[model samples]
Target: MKLFECQNCGQPLYFENTVCESCGHRLGYIPDMNTVSALEPEGDQWRALASSGQLYRFCQNAELDACNWLIPSDHTETHCAACRHNRTIPNLADAENMARYRKLEMAKHHLFYTMIKLKLPLKNRIDDPQGGLAFDFLSDQVDANGNVTTVLTGHDEGLITINVAEADDAEREKRRTQMGEPYRTLLGHFRHEIGHYFWDKIVRDCGEEALEKCRAVFGDEREDYGQALQRHYNTGAPPDWQNNFVSTYATAHPWEDFAETWAHYLHIVDTLETARSFGIKVRPRIKLGHELEAQVDFDPHKANNIDELIENWLPLTYAVNALNRSMGQPDFYPFILSPAVIAKLGYMHELTH
Candidate 1:
């Protein structure tokens, strides 16, 4: 989420920009350097101006307009680091599906950006078939009568399946309303599901001592997950659920709680980085006090601790939400993170550091 400018023209760039608007320079993201640069042709490969002396090629997915990640010319893998984790993709021949698939890739790439910046472990299924990160973007299930069946977006072990329909704004908004959820988006789904994948690696695979600590923070995940989820649906979260959980769904089970908190942690870190990139500062006037002022001059990904993250996050969210309200938009941050929730977030921070 850090600010990027085209190396050739200094045009402010976005994460997924395939071409520089200012100078019409072709762009590619260099994963190892975590940078996006204008490309200059160098025979079969291209030289990235931001990362000089290296020959690079866009991920093969780039041919389909689905990815902009770069792979070294010498690297054996054709897929970039992010696209290599794809276990399944929607039917690309269908124009609609192809569009949705592209949207999904955009979000997935952003997810990988944060993971890489945080230095989190990323082992794709190819690297560890038994337990490694992978994605499955699926179409809606259909019965013999051609009626839509069901396709739930979820994570099982290390594989994350996304119902491709989630990429459609209207469909996603409809579901959000039906589920009584405050927020829903393609990126949110990816962030939340990946939390499950990381839990497997950082907690489950870390041994009994680490697992015990996770349990202490998230509650006993040993509780019957199926039964708990059933109960949560039959009887919605307790009225006071906000006092403990980030979202109503988080109350379903300990695993959900961890994932919800993890998603929020990602949200906070990524947004804060964007704010820093733009040199955003919040200093409310009228003597509201220093608590409402925050200067994001440091890299949020390498924040000293969760407390530091939350300190800056609070003021930034406050300002952004107010700006959103000014524009007649919904609050940028609708859910409240209580003291208990903050403690859980701290544990999630500990998982990374």
Candidate 2:
């Protein structure tokens, strides 16, 4: 999520930019280099100007406009690092499906960007067919009896399934309101689900010591997940849930608590990195001493401790929330961070490192 610019023209660029607007040069992301670079067409291949003249080809999914990542031309693999993990994509023949799939890819690619930045383990189905990470984008099915079965977004083993409908802003907003969620987005969904994937890989499989530490912070994930969710829906979160949990839904189960907290951990670090990229420093005119002042001058991903991140995050949230209100919009971040929640986030920080 760091800022990128067109190497050819020095024009500002974005994560999804496929072509530099100012210089008219084609663009492709070099995953290993972790940068979006200007490209020069070289017969059937491309020369990455920012990658020491390395020759490459677009990921196979690029033909569908579903990916703009690159692959070395000499490499046998056709897909880029991120798209290679997709086990299933919606039927591209359907125009709506194609559009929705594109939206999903944009979010998924952003998730991978952070994953790569964090050096998290990534094993596509090809790498570990039995338990490697993968994705499935599915559509709702309607029966002849006029019954519609909605596809639920979730993760099982190493496969993450997402309902294509979530890509539609209207449907997503409706679900957010119905579920009483203050914030929800395609990127949030990816981060939350991937949290489950990592819990399996890093916590569950690591060892007894790791499991014990996780249990101490996130509670015993061995609790009955199905029963916990059923009870949660029936009675709802406890009145003082915010004192111990990040969200009402997080109160459903220990596993959920971890996932919800993990997602927020990603939210804080990534947004802080973005703030640093812009050299954002908040110093309100009516400052209450240094409590409200912050300067994102360090790499959030490599922060020495969770407390450091929280200190920097609070000021940014306060500043942005005010800016959002100025435009008559809801707060950019609408949740509070309690000491207990910060502890869980600390666990996530430790685990990622």
Candidate 3:
């Protein structure tokens, strides 16, 4: 993430900031422009400082104490662009549910930011006959009682389900340790699940030719998903899994391989954007159009194209990881992208262009 500032006072601001501390200006995120603008009340509602004619208000869910985004009241959609598609939220009667849901919402916003930056189309599941894109911030076994026995995170069709427990640092850390995953976070979960959503949107929707190519590159996705999942749980990943798959689970199915690669694509792009913000640069050796295209201008707030993105990222990640070692902290980036992974990333890059 890049730094933000108050439009009124030029004071430092954060993505989630509702009020600028230095200038005391009310702030709202404009999704259309991918900007957070300082605002002033116009009569009873809020208007952007740069465009006062556009009427806006904090999300009604915010009034109910659930969201922090702004929305146009005159618009037919009651929820903000981000919140409008929420299919299921945990019961807010329990205080913990609200906090967890808020955290999930924040992560979702970041996910949407990257998706929009890539010019990826986002349609809510409700808007699609097969349920295109939906969210389920759920109460899992870890968060809920009364005979509930459900896993915290999973994606099916277009619905991404997240266990509220994942929002709790301690609980998430414990799961991370148990799962032996090098990296995990709320944002990671969102990116990964959205990967699944996009695979369905892109690969599954594309015609037979694309499906054949995907199967040849990844694997056959026709395997029974439930059986493959059961087998993965029972027997664990294959011994030589690392040679072909981005993750152990990626070996379960071709669809998973696509999702894992998609998530990594987001990770690479976002991290590269952050790196460029800090003035990190890499010496370009080979000149591929796609590689050069990955270079992005470092905007501390808005998103940019994926080209020029990973160029700066490769170096910035190395420097940060070394810096972390100097401080006795774990490496900031712990995963290695093999040549095969790079090929998969290339496929994703093609999708973006």
Candidate 4:
């Protein structure tokens, strides 16, 4: 979520940009460098203008315009670090599926940006046979009458499955409303499910002490997941659910609580980084309390403590929500981070840090 620019031309580039319009330079993101740079044509490989004489090739997914990452010329892999994690993609022959897959890729790349920035371990399936990450972007199964059947978005072992239909705003909003969700998006789906994967990687394998600590914060994971979820659906969350859980659904199970908290932690950190990129400092005009003021001069990703992170994050979320309200739009962040939620988030911060 950090800011990016075309290294050759000093032109700002969005996360999804593949070209620098100001300089007519081909652009590609280098994950290792965490940069977008201009490229020059070499005899058989392209040389990155940022790193002279180093030959690189666009990721293979560039053929579909689904990626803008570059691979070192001598690298055996054709796909970039991010693309290699994908185990399956939707059927591109279907126009609708292709459109959805593109959206999925955009969100996935953004997710990878955060993971890389956080310096998290990202092993592909081939790298770690028992504990590795992969993704499967799939479309819903449709009946003869065109009704979508069993398409689930979840994480198992290490594979994160996403329903490509989440890309469609209408469909996504429909589901969100039906489920009484406060917020939902393709990127949110990725972050939430990937939380499950990390729970496996970090908590399950870390040791008994770490696992026991997690249980203390979230709840006992010994509950029957299927039955707990079914009961949760049949009977909604308790009236006091928000007192402890980050969201209503988090009350369903210990796993859901951890995943929801993890997703929110990612959301806050990544969005706070974007605010820092623009040198946004919030100082309310009114003689409001100092709590309304925040300056983001330091790297949020490296925030040494949860207090520092939350200090920057709260004011930024408040400022953005204010801006949205001025435009007659809903609050940018509708959920409240209660003290209990903050404690849970602190645990997550500690775990990742």
Full-model lDDT for every candidate? 0.92, 0.94, 0.75, 0.89
> TM per model?
0.98, 0.98, 0.87, 0.97
Query: Over all chains combined, what TM-score does candidate 4 have?
Result: 0.97
Q: What is the C-alpha lDDT profile of model 2 across 331-350, one tens digit per residue?
A: 99999999999999998998
Estimate the lDDT of model 4: 0.89
Q: What TM-score would candidate 3 get against the native?
A: 0.87
Residue 98's lDDT within candidate 2 is: 92
Comparison by TM-score, 1 against 3, better one:
1
Full candidate order by lDDT, most accurate first: 2, 1, 4, 3
Per-residue CA lDDT of model 4 for 1-353, tens digit only, reads 87888877798888898879899888888888888888888786788877866789989999998999999998999899999999999999999988888899999999999999888889999898677999998877878998878679999999998988899999999999999998999999999999998898899889999899999999888899999999999999999998898899999999999999999989988988888888888887776748679988888778887788888888888889889999998788888788889999999999888
Q: Which candidate is the best by lDDT?
A: 2
Candidate 4 local lDDT, residue 52: 67
For model 1, where is the 10-residue window of minimal lDDT?
A: 282-291
For model 3, what is the alpha-carbon lDDT of residue 148? 62
User: In candidate 4, which residue ranges exceed 4 Å CA deviation?
Assistant: 144-148
Instruction: Give the Cα-based TM-score of candidate 2 against the true structure.
Output: 0.98
Better of 3 and 4 by lDDT: 4
